[model samples]
Target chain A: DVKVTQSSRYLVKRTGEKVFLECVQDMDHENMFWYRQDPGLGLRLIYFSYDVKMKEKGDIPEGYSVSREKKERFSLILESASTNQTSMYLCASSFEGYEQYFGPGTRLTVT
Target chain B: QQPVQSPQAVILREGEDAVINCSSSKALYSVHWYRQKHGEAPIFLMILLKGGEQKGHDKISASFNEKKQQSSLYLTASQLSYSGTYFCGTGVMEYGNKLVFGAGTILRVKS
Candidate 1:
């Protein structure tokens, strides 16, 4: 079975703080993605990486950046956290053109 | 663009059936379905790649209409364990491996 793990299950940060969410996948998938889930908004993509050092912006990439320095790990970075950035962050990895496997998710709270 | 889901929520008895629909304005290369229980990561349910193709496991099935850029998930003889939020993720050729997910349809099952 494929497994995706996130660095944190829940996190709290003050406004103007920097936050990082990490994800690792054991399946050696080529594509990794970051998404934020909010009520009535579903899962909106933040960023995605197809290969090491290759990144692409999804529909809602503002205030967020991603890093894919290695094939197994992907990280999402919030340069400066804000209250509006609080959300459930999900990381997913998949083979090109295949179903994505998601991590357990990190619920981030910004105060 | 994000896919639109119908019947934002639904309630069903143990033996009843329900259908959740997802529609997209753009052409779709594939349609993926996932079910996420409360406080858990979304789990991949099924993926429909061919136009007009129907696929399922157990009593849950899905159909993709490529021409109409839409897909529908069917749950028959639902069980308590089937209660969750159902999300449809649509993949477009132009979007590469990224999927645009719908807002989600919440399902509640009563014994």
Candidate 2:
């Protein structure tokens, strides 16, 4: 089975603090994505990388950046944590455009 | 653009059927379905491609309408384990493989 591992299951950060959320996929998938899920807002894409060292901004990419140093690893960084930025963060990888296997997700709270 | 989902939430009994719809303004190359249980990651259900394919796995099925630019997920005889939030992720051909998911529909199945 393919496994997508998230670095943290839960996180609490103070305002203005920098935060990092890590995601690693065991399968050699070429595409990785980062999304933030909010109540009623659904899952909004933040950033995605099609290949190593290649990244693209999604709908809501402000104050957020991504790093994909390796094909199996993708990271989401909050430049400065804010209350509005707190939500359930999910990571996903896919073989092509078909189905995406997601991580367990990290619930982050900013105060 | 993010696809719109109808019937934000639904409650059904075991063995009942339900339909979840996702419509997008832009043309879609593919539509992906995923179910996420409370406090868990979204699991891929099915994917519909541009050829207007209808995909199904087990009792869950989905159809993509290329002309309407919409997709619908059909859950027949839903089980207790089927209770969760269902999301549709749309991929436009011009956008590469990055997907924008719809506002999810929360389903509650009772015995």
Give the chain A TM-score for each candidate. Answer: 0.99, 0.98
How would you encode candidate 2's per-residue C-alpha lDDT over A1-111 as one tens digit per residue? 999999999999999999999999999999999999999999999998999999999999999999999899999999999999989999999987768999999999999
lDDT per residue for candidate 1 within B4-102, as digits (tens), equals 999899999999999999999999988999999999999989889855554446668888888899899999999999999999999999989999999
DockQ of candidate 2 relative to the true structure: 0.91
DockQ values, each candidate = 0.90, 0.91
Each model's backbone clash number: 0, 0
Q: Each model's TM-score, in the order given?
A: 0.97, 0.97
Model 2 chain B weakest lDDT span, ten residues long: B51-60
lDDT of each: 0.94, 0.93
**lDDT accuracy of residue B26 in candidate 1:** 94
lDDT (Cα, 0-100) at B51 in candidate 1: 52
- Candidate 2 is scored at a TM of 0.97
